[model samples]
Target: MKEVLLVGFGAVGALCTLTSKSLSRSGIARVTAVARSNYGIVRGKYSLCLTTRRSRVCNTVASAADQAYDYVVVTTKAVPELRLTPEILSPLLSPEYTNKFAQPTYLLLQNGLNVEKDLYNAIRKLNQGKPSIVCAALYVGTNLAAPNVVVTNDLVNHFSQRESLFLGIYRHEDHTTSANSADETALLQDLGSIFQRGGSAITIVPEIQRVKFAKNFWNLSFATFATLTGYTVPSLFRSPPASKDEQCNPYLYPITAELVQQHSIPAIKTTMKELLNRDPDNSHVPSMLLDARRSQPMEVEVIVGEVHIDMLYALLLVKQNQILGRMMAQ
Candidate 1:
């Protein structure tokens, strides 16, 4: 059986695991997952059952004696509070077990722009040597409906609308190829086929960073706005300015629009278009937004700050351009 290990079993992790299980049961790959804390129930339906053949290890490391896995999916949240450094993964990253599960193909299913850079630095400090790494951009919108259970939209509807997950392998600077190098075509094709078999929609691109940056823009915008204001999705989406609230206060709508359009929207859009060549029409509410609405600490620094830095450098490249005047005029 082809073996796989998943790290960080949150919302995306749950979806990834379920999809893996379906594929494995169909003889695609054997799967196991490692979680920091074993919440007896995930999402809402599946109970954490140790009796199953597929293992779920907690507070343990897979040494070299254990067979190397085919894939390692890292789904840890990219926020500072939830970040997983190589030192944090030292127990499982030790060299003593290199012969075992150390050489598995790795995939980081996280959000943010510099995750690969951070992971590389962390691993270089902790790992014996580099392992193959792939990057995944999980596009499906899902939430925990119950312990061990996740509620996702129907696969058919999701794919039909092109809301399926967008996945891509990574290309480090050391790789001797252009930004659009076709290194992982076969791997992406395999992954895409696997996801499709599991009833998911998928598009595997060569440059995952572009898509990653694009997603970061939407993430930062929603997270920054929703966090500062204590409002949930239903409330914000329903309570538009032109709605009932405007009768008593005409200023509220324009104020909100100006805040969004002037500060958050422009900053995000400018960064995304300049850096990743992304269009503003395709938008998404990032996980940070969900966390903020629920009164959770924000991931603003990692997601938004990185983009701002990149945008500054981008601005430098076009500092003398005529178009700058037209863009800033708005």
Candidate 2:
């Protein structure tokens, strides 16, 4: 049985535990979670509730010292300010514990473009052994209902909406290639199977970089607007005002799809033309807006800001190339 260790016991992490447990029933995998703060609450008994209203207690661990795991899944948020190396991975990948645990496969289930690069580099710097890195772009809608309880939406609906877990190997040398090794391919297939058995739809893709870029494109277009305007997706789709008083009210005047198409769509389309695009059926509350509402720092730098920076750099490069072309012609 493959021993799995899950870091970040939030909504995604808990949902993974439930799926991993289902895999355990088939004698394929055994799952354990590393609880950083909620160790006490998670260790004894914690429940996961599905959209169907089914609930079950999940398994968790305080640490990974006792056993070696074959896989480590990270479901943490990808924020620029957070140093995950020391805060999360050090305990497992440190020099002293390197020998104790096997060089496990690292599955990063975080959003944003190039989110896996830093963590992958940090793990490589360990020099213990090369751990196979799998980058997963998750589309699962989940939330923590309580300290020890996680609730997830229906998998059927999630899949119907074309929301799936996209997985691929992380290789810095080439972002366009598929899994280079047979082992990596097998592992990915196995993971896909496990997730499928657990009821989550998953796809192993070749062009993960493009996939990340596409995901970020949507995020940047919708999330940035929602974050800046403090409006949800549904709010953005709210009907326009009929009367002058309604027109004057800020709350009534939503930045609707018509507005976006008229004013923002052209720029958005131009900006994301190269990436070529990649949603949910739920009430369209962007995560950034949720973070802002909760007074938590949004992932502005990693998600929206990074895209802006890349676009600026691309424009600069294009301008430089044009100048050189003109000079050569002259």
- Best of the candidates, lDDT: 2
**lDDT, each prediction:** 0.55, 0.62
Q: What is the Cα-based lDDT of residue 228 in candidate 1? A: 40
Q: Compared with the true structure, what per-residue lDDT tens digits does model 1 show for residues 219-271?
A: 55444544445443333343336766456533458778789778988897666
TM-score of each: 0.66, 0.71
Clashing pairs in 2: none
Report the poorest 10 consecutive residues by lDDT, candidate 2: 49-58
lDDT of 2 by residue, 195-237 (tens): 7766666788765777777777666766666666677655555
Cα RMSD of all models vs. native, in order, equals 11.2, 11.6
| Candidate 2 TM-score versus the reference | 0.71
Candidate 1 residue 176 C-alpha distance from true site, Å: 10
Model 1 Cα displacement at 80 (Å)?
Answer: 3.6
